[model samples]
Target: MALSNNNSKRATLGLGAIAVAGLVSTPLLAQDAHQLIRDNCVGCHTESGTTAAPSFSRISEQRKSPEGWLMTINRMTHLRGLELTSEDKRALVKVLADRQGLAPEETEGYRYLLEQNTNIIESGINQGLTETCGRCHSEARFALQRRSEDEWKYLVNFHMGQFPSTEFHSMSRDRPWYQIAFNETAVELGQRFPLHSKEWSNWQAAARNDLMGRWRVTGFVPGKGEFAGWMSAAKTAEGRYDVTLTGRYADGAALAGEGKATLYTGYEWRAGLTIDGVKMRQVMAANEQGTALDGRMFLAAEREIGGDMRAVRDQGKTELVAIQPAYLRAGESTELTLIGQNLAGDIDLGDGVVVEKVLSRNADRITLQARAEGAEGVRMARVGTSKQLSALTVYNTLARVEVLPTDAVTRIGGAGGNMPKVRAAYRAVGYSVGADGKPGTEDDLRLGYMPASWSIKPADEVAAHEKDDRYAGSIDASGIFTPGDAGLNPERKRSANNVGRLKVVASVADGDARVEGEGNMLVSVQDFVRRVLD
Candidate 1:
C-alpha cells in the first residue's frame, strides 16, 4: 500500500522539503525517452544498487526483448492497478523503450555510479535490512543473534508478530526465491551492524520525536466511521498526557471523547478498538494507562427538549408605585383607590379624575381614595401615615366614596351613617372595620373594635332579620324573616271558603292558609283588617 502522506509524523522527518523537491520534476517526457530513463530510472537499478534481480545495465548487456518491458508495465498498471495516470504510463513506457536497458557513456564519477541501479536488487536489500537486522533495533539486541538460516527463519516469524505491517513483509513474501536468497544475506549484514555502511539514525530519530503532542486520526478499521480530523494531546505537569478527540459519529451525531496516551518511538501506530455500542468502540493504545485507538465514536442519546427564560425572580424589587385607570365610561365617575406603602405625605387626585392619589408612609397600611357619581362628593385625596418601610411606595388616584340610596345603614366599628369613614388597618396587630366598610382610611375601624351588622328600618317598614320565634310558634306576617306567604298558616287546619262544606274540606285537605268558616283566624288577616280600619 502507498504510504500516507498526511501522516502527522511526516513533520518530524525533516524531509518535507527534500521529498517535495525530489518529486518536483515533471513526469518523464515521451520524446526524450533515453534522457528520461538516464535521469530517473538508472540511479536505483545498477549492479551496485541491486543484489538479486538483473539491473537495467544487465538488461542492456543481455539485450532483453521489448515485449518483456511492455509486459512489465502492463502488469504493474492494469493487474496491480497502480494509481499511475495514463500520461504517466505513456511517459514511463516511452522512456524505457528508448533506453532499452542501455549502459551510460558518462565518465567515471559518483553521479555516474548512482545512474546504474536496479529496482529489484535495491528493493530486496532494503527489505532484508529492515526485517533481519532491524529498522532501528539497538545494536546490542542484534549482536546476540548468531543463528543459522533455519534459526533465522524462526526468528523472523517471531519478529513478524512484533512488526508485521511494515515494508519488511512485502519484500520477504512478494518476490521470487532468488530475490529471497539475496535478502537473506542483506539481512545478515544489517543485523551484524558495522558490517554495512547504511545507517537509519535519522529515520529512527524522526520516528521518536514525531509522536508527541496533537495528531489527527487518518484511517480506521472496516465498517468504522471516517477518521479525518486532528485531535490534541498534551502532557500534564506530572508527565502524563491527556489525549482528546472531537468529531462526528457514523450516525452524524457529535462525538467528543478522550483518553490518556503516550508516544511510541517505532513504526506508525495501528489504531485498535474494543467494541462498546452501536457506532461506538474503545480506543486501543500502548500507553501506560491503556491502548489508544482512532475511529471510535462517543455518541449520546437524542433529545427534544426546550427551555423557558421568563421566570427568574428579582430579589431587589420595587413595589407597584402608581396606577391610573384607563378607559372609564364618560360621566360614569368610576373610583380607583391608591394605598401607598413606604410613601411620603398625602397625595392629590386631580379634578375630573375618578382615581385616588391617597398615600401613606406606613408600608403596612394605605389610605385609599375613591370616586363616584354623587351630586355632592369630594374628589382627589390622600390618606396615609408618614413612615417608610424600606423604599417601596404606592400611588393611587382616589375617587369620592359615596353612599347609594338603596344602601341600608350598617354600623361599622359600632357606628352607622349615610357615609361612614374608612381607613386601612394592619390586621397583624388587630382587626378593625372601616366606618363605611371601605378599607384604608380614617373611617377604618381600628384594632380592638368589631363591626356591628345592623340594618335601619322605617316605622312602617319591616325589619330584615331572621326572627327567633321558637317559643311563640308564630312569625310576624310583615317580617322579612317570615318563612312563607302571609296567607299560609299550615297548622291552623282550615278549609277553603270558596267551596261548600264538604267540597271545602277536599280543597284545603293538604294545603295551608285556607278559610273553613267566616270566623277562622289568621295573624296576617287580622293585621291587614286592623290597618285598613285604623
Candidate 2:
C-alpha cells in the first residue's frame, strides 16, 4: 500500500536548503556530477513538470537511498538517453550521499523566519479581536464559543450585523476555506479573532460612578424594560463614604456597596459594576437637614457626572437622644418606666441591656422598665426599627450598711432592774420593842435594819454596832418611861397607831428601772410595796 505523503519521511522543499539535499543522494567527487545535474540535467525532467519537461528541483528534497540513487542515475544515463562516464557516475553518487544530512545554517534561518511571522499573526489578531471584544464581552463569551468551521462562520456573521466593520466581513467568507485547509491551525488562529468591535470599544470608554448608602428604586415604565433607581451616598469618615442603591437588571444581582465608607469622590470614584448597565449619583448635599443641599444627589450619566441643583430636604423627625441611668450597680436593680412620647416598641437596648421590668401595656402606649448589673457603667446604645438611633445613659453606685434587730433586751433600756429588793436591802443599826410589851432590845440581834434617823451604814459597820452592848443599849439608856392608863389598853392602841411607812427605791442601768423619794426620804421598793399592800 502507498503511504500518505504527509505521513511519509519525505522532506518538504519549503523547509529550506538544509532539508533539500536530504531528499536525494549523489556519489563522491571523482567528477563534477550533482552540480551538473542541477545546472544542466534539471532543466528538463521533473515530477510536477508539465509536458514541456521536468526539473530535479521538485524531487531534491525527496528521500532516496544510495541504491535507489544509483539505479535511477544508471537508468537516466543508459536507458533514458543521458550520457555519463564511470567517473561522473561515481562523483554523482557522492553528491547524493552528501544530501542525506542536514545543514545547520539553513535550519536556523528557517526557524527564525517562522517565529517572526507567528508573532505578527498573533499581534494583528489580538488588536482586531481579543482586545476589542473583551471591552464589552467577558472572557466567558470566547470560552463558550467552541464550534466547528461552519458554525464559527455563522457566529461571525451574526456579530457583523451589530458591528459592521470591514475586517469582520472579510473573515465571513475566507474563514471556512482556511479552516478546512489547515484545521488545527484554523481553530487556534480563529480563537484570537474578534466578533464585534464598535460595541466593545464604546463600552470601554463609557464613564461610570460607584455609589453607597440607603436607597429606594422603582421599576421602568411598561414596554420600556429599562431599569431606573435612586441612590444616596453619604460621606462617612474623612473623605470616605457609604453608598446604597436599588436597581434591577435582566441579570440577577443586587447593586450595593458595603456598610463602611471609602476615600474617593467626584472624578476619583471607583467604578460601579454589575451584569446590567448602571447609572450612579454621588450625594453632593449633606446627609443632615436644613442645609442648602440637604437631599440633593450628584448625577452620573454616560461620560460626565454632577449633582442635582434642586435640593430635597429630609423630613424632620424626633429622635430619642438619651435615656437616664445607663448602668446599674452591682447586685442592684432599678425600674425604668418608659415616659417619652412617640417611643417605638421595637427599640433595641444593646447587648447586656435586657428588658427586666415591664410596667404596663395599653393600646395608646407601653410602659417598660429594665434592670441590669452595673458592670462599671456600660453605655446603653439604642437602636430601633425606625431610623432613630439614640443613646441612653444609666449610672449607679454600690453601697452597704449594717442592720440590727429591734427586739433585743439591751435596746429596751437598763438591764431590767438588776438591783436587790427592799426585803433583801441592807439597813443601818437600830432596835425595836417586842411582843412582851417591855424594852426588849437584843444586843446580839444580827438584823438587816435601818437607823431610827433613817440613815444607812455599811454592812460591816451595822454588824459590829449591833454586837456592841454600849451601842445597842444607848437607845434604851435614854428611855424616859411614863405609866400607861390602867384600864385603857394602851399597848393595843400603840400597836394599831404604829404604821411602818417604809419608802422603797430601785435602780436600773438604763433608767427603765426607777427609784422614788417619799416626802424627804430615800426608800426601798419592797418596803413601799409592803406599805401599799397594808
Candidate 3:
C-alpha cells in the first residue's frame, strides 16, 4: 500500500546517503579535523557553548553509527543550508564516524537496519516510543544513537518545533503527545541508551580484528539454495581490504568474485563484489575474537534477494560449516558434500547410513556417495574432530509441507516510473512428523527446502470479488512472485492499479500424494520515495 505523505517525508529526510565508500583508518588527524570542522561548521556552531547551536564538545557527547552520522550531516546540508564539497563531506563523515561511533556491542540487535533486510518485523518495542517516533520512521533509527537525558529531551522539543503536526497525528491526538514524548519517552531512552557506557570506553581502547587472511564461507540463498566457498583478503590500505571469493552453489555452479571492503567502527564490514556477472553487497560484523564474520549478503541492485552469511576465519583448526543437501531419502543413495576447513580422517554418518564410496577428498571439502537404510531421524555427521549437530536427516515419508514465509509482500512498479518492482522469493520446506507422530510439534523431523509447483489464488471474498489473483501477479515454478505492472488499469472497478491480497500455494509431490503448503502475499503499490534506513 501507499505510505502516508508525512511518513514519506520523514523517511526521505531521516535517511541520508547510502554509506558505501571505502573508508580509511584515520581519515584526518585531530588538528586537520578541527580545521575542517571550523571551516564548514563554525559558521552556525561556534567554538564556545551557545544557545543557537550545539558546540563541538556537545555534539561529541553522543555516539552513532557511520550511517547515523551521515544522516546528521545530510540534515544539516538539506535543512540548515550547510555547504561542503563531496570530498569534504566524505572526509567529515569518516572523521566523525571514527571519533564518535557506537561500540560494536551497542549495535547488536539493530544490524538488520544497516544490512537493509526487508523481511523482518519489528516487535517488543515501547508503546510510547512507537506512538511518538515510530509512527514516522523505524525504531532502529533512534535506537542506533546514544545521548544524554537533556539531549533526548531536546530532541523531543526539536521534533515538536520542526513537525508541528506530529502531536496532532492519528495516534497522538487522543493523548498528551508532548508530555508522553518529552517526559516519559525521552527519560526512558536516555536511561536505556546513556551517552557514557563502560562498553564504549572499553571498545575505544581495544584492538580491532585483522581482516587479512583466508575465511571459510557458508551461506543459504532463499531461492538459490546453499553455497560454500573461501574468501581471501589482503590489506590494501588502513581499514581497507582487497578480497576474492571462490565458491560453488549446491548444484556445483561456479561462484567466484573480487571486491574491495571497508571497515567502519572497527567491526562493521561493508563490501561490494561482482559475482558471476551480478553485483552484490556484503554487510557483516567481525566478532571481537576475530573468529567469525556474521551477517547478510544481497544483490546490490535488489537487497531482497539475499541470504545469511557466516564466515569463519581459517586458523589451522578443523571446522564443519555445513552439509549440502542435508537430508536424504531412506533406502536411497545420494551424493553429499561436506563443507568446512581442515577436514580429514574418518567420516561418520550415524547408524542406518553407509558411506559406500568417496568421490573426492580435500582439506576444505569432502564429497561422498552415501546410502540410507531406513534411517528415520536427525543424524550428526563427524569428520575427524569436527562435528555438526543435526547435520543430516533421513526420512521415510513426507509428513507435510510448509512455505518459508507464511506472510509476504511485493510491490508493482516499472510502468513508466522510477521505482522498480519488488519481487518475493519463497521456498517449500518438508517435515517428517518424527517420533511425536504429530505434524507441527517440536519433535517433528525437519527436512530441508523441497521442490514444488507454485500458484496463486484469491484469499477471501473481498479478494475474489476484486479478481486479485488474476491481476496481482504471477508465481514461477521456482516460487518467485513477480508483481504486475504499476499505473491504473481500466479493467478494474475503479481503474485501480494491480494491488491485491492473494494466497500463495506450493504443491510438492510425495509418491501418490500431493503435499500442499500455503502462504499469504500482499501486492502493493510502488513506493515513491525509497531510503536506506527502510
Per TM-score, the best of the predicted structures is 3
RMSD of candidate 1 to the true fold?
Answer: 45.8
lDDT winner between candidates 2 and 3: 3
Q: Candidate 1: lDDT of 446?
A: 22
TM-score-sorted candidate list, best first: 3, 1, 2
User: Estimated TM-score per prediction?
Assistant: 0.19, 0.16, 0.87
Query: Which numbered prediction scores highest in lDDT against the true structure?
Result: 3
Q: What is the C-alpha lDDT of each candidate?
A: 0.27, 0.29, 0.79
Q: Write the per-residue lDDT of candidate 3 for residues 357-429, one digit (tens) a residue.
A: 9999999999999999865987888888874333798998889888866777788877787676777677788
Collision count for each candidate, in order: 35, 43, 0
Model 2 Cα displacement at 1 (Å)?
Answer: 99
The CA lDDT at 31 in model 1 is: 38
Question: What is the clash count of model 3?
Answer: 0
| Model 3: colliding residue pairs | none
Q: For candidate 2, lDDT tens digit of each residue in 1-534? A: 000111111011111101111111222342344456654466554434433333254244332223234544665665457776665554454455334311121122222121111111112234334433433333322332223344455444544554555233444343543233244433442443332234223433444233333333222211122232334557543333444554442122333332222222111222222212333332222221212222112112211111122222223322233232223333334553322223444646665566766676432123456655533333444434334443443322211111110000000011133221111111122222233333333422211111112221112453333332111111111111111111212344333211122222211111132221111111112111111100
